[model samples]
Target: MANLPTLGQRFRRGWNAFLDKKAYENFNIIGGGYSGPNYRTILSTNTEQSIISPILNRAAVDISMIPLRHSRVDENNIYKGTIDSGLNNCLSLTANIDQTAYSFMVDVAMSLFDEGIIAVVPVDTSISILDSSSFEILSLRTGKIIQWYPRHVLVRLYNDNTGQREDLTLLKSSIAIVENPLYSVMNEPNSTLKRLVAKLNLLDAIDNQSGSGKLDLIMQVPYAIRSEQKRELAEKRLAALETQLKDSKYGVAYADAT
Candidate 1:
């Protein structure tokens, strides 16, 4: 029993398991990806890791908060007075029955930033051709682009009234597609941000191991587990390591022989 942990040291170990409830409950699916296997890992990573979501959310909010107006610029493309237009009325008064300008823009901007593309489908409009003079929006919905076509595209638009996603195929004329603002950077197959997300996702998967049980790791104590002082120090170090592993965004702890 000399090499074994004393009773008090064993009791101290239980403190490390305090934050294990979530890990325990989600033992089967700690690091599982989102429903689709396509390009949504960045969004999933945003949920788990605290690296990118805040910036994206803040950008969306800031962009949505900006005042929008319909205006005619001068011949030199300089600032001109605002124009009274139906477009301005539709955008400012009501994006849809359930959303204001800010809410609608938040959804649009978030999708554009997170998924790189969003579809603005004209749910109800005055004209099919959308002629500048006659075009008027009665209602609109923001949607995630599911399929692309020359003349039409499929989208999954969330209905606020029903609280569910409604799939719709919109003709090219009835839908406007907005891509990410940083299209040049995000369009790359070898996107650095995507690579970082992949790495974080893999790390998250590894971290799931700790959710089920303790890591299959060992440490050779520098000296004998004899004196009370050494035992306490060793226990302190082990408890710290355990807490670090459990409490980290991804379960990783750094240590070296010191």
Candidate 2:
């Protein structure tokens, strides 16, 4: 053990030692190119060997290399901007790095949601007690208003002129009203790419709304895209939150609450 180093020391040594390493050479694919194999390679030399590798751990250093693959060319096939755009949107998210207005807005919105800033509005109609003159009356109900308090207003519709009987069908319309304000904020053309920027900002604002106070029924915004990556990110975040809940010693963490 005279020469042996501790894990921490070894890790540091590996990181420092691997600072200069050549990773890729002869970066070419087989059976590629229009005329012949269009090959490219970093001819290994003192110059190539000087390239650096990233230290990952005490035992591992990270270096990236081009993969060898067969290439095909078809004359009839045409390459179009549409294909590029599609690839940029789906397969390559980096395409939108500069394109998206304020990239952090999505993260801000998601963080707000993760921090219990999200609110859910129940679409189903149910019985609600309305007090009029200290007397409860069944009335035709439309919806419960959701907004910032003190300034927020709630308007309920009743079935009869006397407001005695409650109508549940009208309650479904509540969801409709909840969404309008968000769109209105998005549509305001006071800023850059106003609508899209507003939509993204609105999401962040909505998520932060729950932090202000208690929320009964509120609107939930849609995600940018219901993709597998988004789902996996959500699942991982939820798992982390669950682990924190377990550590908190809070009795019976409710999965349904998330």
Tens digit per residue, CA lDDT, model 1, 16-97 = 5676576668634544334542211234453333566677688878998888877789999987887766567656767776
For candidate 2, write residues 1-258 as lDDT tens digits. Answer: 478778998777755436543432332422122442111111223321122111111111111111211233468654423333322232223212222212222322222222212221222123331212122111111233333344333333222223232223222322223232233332223444545445766887988886864435332324543888977766676676567666766534443334
Off by over 4 Å in 1: 1-50, 74-79, 127-133, 160-163, 181-258
For model 2, state the Cα shift of residue 25 in Å.
96
Backbone N/Cα/C clashes per model:
0, 14
Question: What C-alpha lDDT, on a 0 to 100 scale, does residue 140 get in candidate 2?
Answer: 13
> Worst 10-residue stretch by lDDT in candidate 2?
52-61
The predictions' CA RMSDs to the true structure, in order, are 22.4, 36.8
lDDT of 1 at 135: 67
Output the lDDT of residue 242, model 1. 91
